[model samples]
Target: MRSIYLRITQPVIKLMLALTWSLASLQAAQAGETPIPVEKFFKSAQFKDAQLSPNAELIAFLAADNDNRSMLVIMNSKGDATPTVITRYSNLDVIFFHWVNNERLVYGISEKDLGAGEKNSGSGLFAIDKDGKNSRQLIDRFVKAGAPKFRLLPARTRFISTTGNESSDDIYVGQNSTERMNAGINLFRLNTRTGQTEIVAVPPHSIDFLFDPSGQVRIATASKNGITSVHYKENKNTEWVQLYQFDDTVEDGYSPVFIGTSGQFYVTARNGKDTAALYQYDTKSKSLIPNPLLALNGFDFDGDILFDNQQNKLAGIRYETDAHASVWFDEKDKKIQSQIDALLPNMVNLVDKGRSQDANVRLVKSFSDTHPGNYSLFNVDTSKLTQLGVVNPDIDPAKMAYRDSVRYKARDGLEIPAYITLPKGRPAKNLPLIVMVHGGPFLRGGHWNWTPAVQFLASRGYAVIEPDFRGSTGYGKKLHQAGWKQWGLAMQDDLADAREWAIKQGYADPKRVCIAGASYGGYAVLMGLIKEPDLYRCGISWVGVSDINLLYDVSWSDTAGNAWTKYGMPKLIGDQQKDAEQLQRTSPLQQASRLKNPLILAYGGADVRVPLIHGTKFYDAVKAHNSKVEWIVYPEEAHGWGLLKNNVDFWTRVEKFLDENTAVK
Candidate 1:
């Protein structure tokens, strides 16, 4: 009986493998052909931004209709019951939400109006009960004759302090921004007995906002450009102090970490030595104590100072190092090596357990180099994880290869981290590689998931390498700050270095390397082919910013504001006027003639960030050079390919381009 069962199962598995290979081959041959419903992917049944309800018994997440109209939905804890929409606004999108009580949820809504670049416009507050009842706007917009009156502060703070225990906690909300932009938030107090709402903290900007462990507001953090102060009415005596004041060179306050019991404030700061160390400001002593846990120079880790307010016995601190997780035993003055081992395995198990419950969790659990992010949740108490969902699960896993994270010392002695995914069922030597750079030149990179593009290329048998080069977030501030003035210089070198590292590691062939990315990543791809033409066989850029100067060259009518200057332009890409030559050297358009590699460019017609002009200008320049370039424009799309048809179409063209141009073994 056992032998017969094995015989039957083995044959079935072998047949399935054969069928998968056949489908892959067919898909490859028809790489340029359109398959599946084009509009189906754009339907926005795609769920995003999920938050567990306050009670932890239900989850309130955002869902969308076929038109991409978003609504708030509530599901049971286990996600067993059908999801019910608490909202039905077709033109409105729920940007974010917070659970008010077990029965009601509050959210910020913004209209889906585009083209004007008004991101914050049409934003207002609303309240809805969990059962899809009593949905009403907390505030509404009105157009009056001749003139209008308005304030940034909300009429109430119901959303911030939702847990019914607001009275016991002292609440404050606006303390971060230096200038109060019309008190941009509303504060409200809800009387539980009569359900009457009263005005609480009037906004423009609170000096600071504080919250307790139960997600309750306890204190407000206040600061001024010239003054360092903590304002709290403690023991009936309201006193303020000039904590540690800095020279005018200092900018911004530390994101305050509150110690619940003593209400002490802790912050991480670099002292005279230019090394980061944790400093605790005692509420009673009014003195600052340097924490020993983070005494190491040139290195920093986020130490969660968990405290059991009831016991006051510092509940131990946990932190992660370069490759290992560590925990600090406060009282013992030593780190718990065993505790780190215990925590990771449990976390892993929780993740593994979650896969069985939610498809999201399961997807994340099965994340590979070729895939994108999968979602899973692990419960600390139960030591179990629930898989919530997975994206693009229809793609067969066997047709893809898993990537391993690798770290290599760059020429500058910087430890660069990257992930290289080999083609499925292919030998390691002489494989074509797509050196993919991540967007956010300032953000983090390549996490586990089912990457349609990566898998699609791997299916055509091209190894893909994604490097989270220097400037990536989640590593530390030092690494991020390093890429400040080195946009096209070091950043471009990092991409090139990845190819060399891969070649040295015996994972890739130097002759058939291609560079690919979208947005900032797209720009990286263009830079790769231009700056290191000999290293790349081809390149792909989708909605990439080509001209650095043109990024800020916009019409007055555009509401994007001076975001480049306001957000990161000063520290990241450099001021346009000051670094004119550097920006010109880095601009892809300036070096378009040097791009010898075959190129594929895709852009959204409505992409205001990079704009259609970016692609058009680059294409025109490439044409002027009489270069071999392929270009495609999606008329209805915005910054990204919202329609699934476009995504599949672009990939199909990409597969054909890579296959025809390069030798993929």
Candidate 2:
């Protein structure tokens, strides 16, 4: 029932001072029912991420400091020792980090101040002790011109994962060769302190690797010419034998999960079913078990297995349905979960245990549709829960909107899953609506949790609906495959269907709907305006693709050279040459003159995926006829806004735009 404040250093005090000024400015800008400022929704969380030491004695986390830079800090889980500032940088921020062992941790850094266009350095890795000693650079941030030769690993080298054995300092790293995009990675066993590495056995053309609980490479998946071959080895002494192969374009076969201590191989497979389920793999027979280990009714197997290192056994399985949940095979852990739930009955409480069974402290992350989430330490011995930190301290669950999972049938009768977030303190009828499309038309969109962008719109009195249209993943094979080659055609229809569904349900005003998204979702925004101008009064698209053909034609884009463009796009999204007619017909660039809705088009100048050209060309075409169009470009940003200042400015503009176009008279 008590809260423990972690000890802070002088730099963190400066960070608090900076946060005060930033928040003061935000408060000065707030007004009306939506008292929460735009900055509150877009600003980085005070506590970015956290992890417990193997023994659960210490906790390491990334915290944003005074300059809005993410710094690495360590604190005692027992709240007894002074928290140590492990890594501090004025310009760069610690982006990714992990505890290598009980005493040492490793992290990767990036330039937070620079946009993707201006960022020239790579994310180099470094290691330091928990006590803020024995600091060493394991990889070079960038290869400086005429720099002296050094022992540090190349900038291209990346830390994959820590060896499960917390007693040792050795970890696994992967380094790609000169032909990085197309070639397999050279696996290495790296020592943190010594900077020495030994080459590990890797399957030919392997793109991914999986290791057992004992830190032995047991499975490798290799991709070549659209075919994915899974290779497996019983031990380090044995050769990797080819298990099975499947076409990358087709949805078939099983994916390797993790090897159990008992040498049982676990995997996830559809097994001739619509949704994927967890099953044990029969190595000898090269097939999945007849019965699934775990399965969900409507959702696919989209989570990881929890292994208890001390007991050398599978403890539980953590998966996602409408929300994240865990199934514990062990009775004691189940009892612990029940207790945590009883204490935090209103939210979803996820319990994470340290590798050492002797560790009494369990890290709990609890959140709900209205809550952004908070991290806490649950002491088993004292039967007490002490709060560590909240993700967004400024967010109030009382003012935030409620997100509900929904489903509606498309024109062809295929059920499309969606999420609808209704504005707080408002009746679920005749509200202004925003059909917010997700970027990855091929990936899953929303989950049953707190989302900043969605909440921000809802706070402004707009009902937001995110449709996991035909091409989106995570639902089942039917929904995913049905989206192939639909792009601006069927995929665009799904957004309109979602809008119609909301209006029919009396949750939206039929005349007050707007469409908005980024990337592919941005593309959908333009297409929605073009194909169904009467349905939407306005449209907002940022860093969106205007021409489908440009996805293949634009060589400067990072997407140009990848496997997705070469193989996946040709099959799933319409081939460049063979389907040129369809591509041109669906392209927003070709039909821009047809769009007459009030529109806002924003693009990141440094975006490599859907470059600024997509926006500039479409603007030129649409602006010639439509005088209501507003165009803005962030030269420093790429793909999406990275800086908090940019995010605040962009969303504030969005708030004004939505009110001007869709607000009730």
Candidate 3:
């Protein structure tokens, strides 16, 4: 709290030291083990995303205001001046803001929700100086009747960037239509000072444009009907020529990574191989430069080049393996990376050179499985990483539990990778286990990160098991494709197998096991209770799908789900027409009667992905079956709660539910 207060500019503003959570003093139930408060795990972060300014002189970050609302706070990178609060929206949180130049910053607003889901609250763009003066609201994304922000965002206008000169009055913008999905975007150069627009170019289709360091639209890509296309131009004045097009049905397709100088196009795609590899497209030959530039073999390289602004060259590639990792291309940057990693050996050191060609000074953020995160300034010439501060000041490394990467073979002899976090200060024994399933079943669900949810459960004497089941990505291509169309059946089995594996290892009490997840993981929880009736004692699902049919049919929902309905649903999920019976049979809402254990259902009132309709209908259906149901509704929230109050409220209730049902009372 003192560190957070020191960073706050105003001293006599009556700082409230009354934190809802604390870590200072604790009773050691076991030697060297302090009981972590549940609120500490579930509460809003003390500070949010941080970034160094263009000159590396100013460090801007989002910090919890005295009111706990998201506020923009700026401090000197060298710690020469006190941190100043720039923009304070008492009603709305500044969800995202960026330093376009040394003088100007553009920020967007949204509800203070968890997971940082991009749900704009019509509270739009704001521009301010480094000193918090001349603050101007650039655009109101969806206008509310309030203090006039800037001009209307022209329906779906998004700020691209201020091209060459950050001090220039003009900024690049993309205008697209919300009326249609996959609608082509019109690129524009708008006067940031006056809100006047100049048309740069109109993309061929709803293809997204890629701007280079000089703010030139170099590459464009779009995918529709399971076929994707890429087009590139030497200059904005040149004719747009088709670079290459690939069948999106072939997995990763020809996805553009980043564009280099002279149209050196880099993309991730599999020509014939399973995993997508990084390749450079040679314009003269009009083909992918024979071999991959950087291929991770088993895993599709899902990262981008670390662009060196000073050198105007590709620095290195930063991609994810288990956690976020980086590989450098530039020797200078690589040398610096090596130095930083050696210094912060425990954490993944992500370094950013602040608009300096010399690379004498840089900002480094060190993070690990155990370490929440700490920021530092790498004085390359001095060869010292000056300690900045931890991302979460509330967390103490001494009290946090260790995360172990574990794997077990499924019934089918397929290797299932997982991370098991045992409770702090306890030996591996028959502990009450929470089988924490992840949200995105198709995504790289369970990575080794400092997750509050996982650590929170582990702090409560629960063995938290996060399994990257058959369909989860990031491991390898084969693991992900195996989950195609598995849904409630094979996917559920993989989770069950993980539980069985844990129980067999004497780490989990089979009688005290509970399944928990969000989104598709939440769907899996229902299926787990349904298919394996004798296994889990309780289950928790929030913002989860209750019906696949609803996912396909909800036109007003998020575009990702709707696109999956068109492209992936037929092949990956199931054919809506032919596989109608299978979809229904697998639907948790359809099979609500199978739920015989304690169940907690949570949903965001405004969740467009899996709307309240799914939760309410499932709740009603389960009520008829006369099963124990705890329904939690967060009205203002979208997919997940963003506000600190809502997060605390929801998690506190969940803690109670688990304690009553799964705790060894």
Separate clash counts for every candidate: 38, 0, 7
**Model 3 regions more than 4 Å off:** 1-27, 31-34, 89-92, 110-121, 144-152, 162-167, 309-312, 559-562, 663-665
lDDT per residue as tens, model 3, 484-577: 8889878888899999999999999998999999988889888888888788989988999998888877766775443456776677778889
Name the regions of candidate 1 deviating beyond 4 angstroms.
1-51, 61-96, 108-124, 139-210, 213-253, 257-288, 292-400, 446-456, 476-478, 552-571, 575-578, 635-638
Judged by TM-score, which candidate is best?
2
Q: Could you tell me the lDDT of residue 303 within candidate 1? A: 49
Across 303-358, the per-residue lDDT of candidate 1 in tens digits comes to 45544444444444433222222233343222222322244231211121110122
How should the candidates be ordered by TM-score, best one leading?
2, 3, 1
User: How would the candidate models be sorted by lDDT, starting from the highest?
Assistant: 2, 3, 1
Model 3 C-alpha RMSD vs. true structure (Å) is: 7.9
What's model 1's overall lDDT?
A: 0.58
Clashes of 1: 38
Model 3 reaches what TM-score against the true structure?
Answer: 0.88
- RMSD for all candidates, in order, please: 9.8, 7.4, 7.9
Error in Å for residue 481 of model 1: 3.9
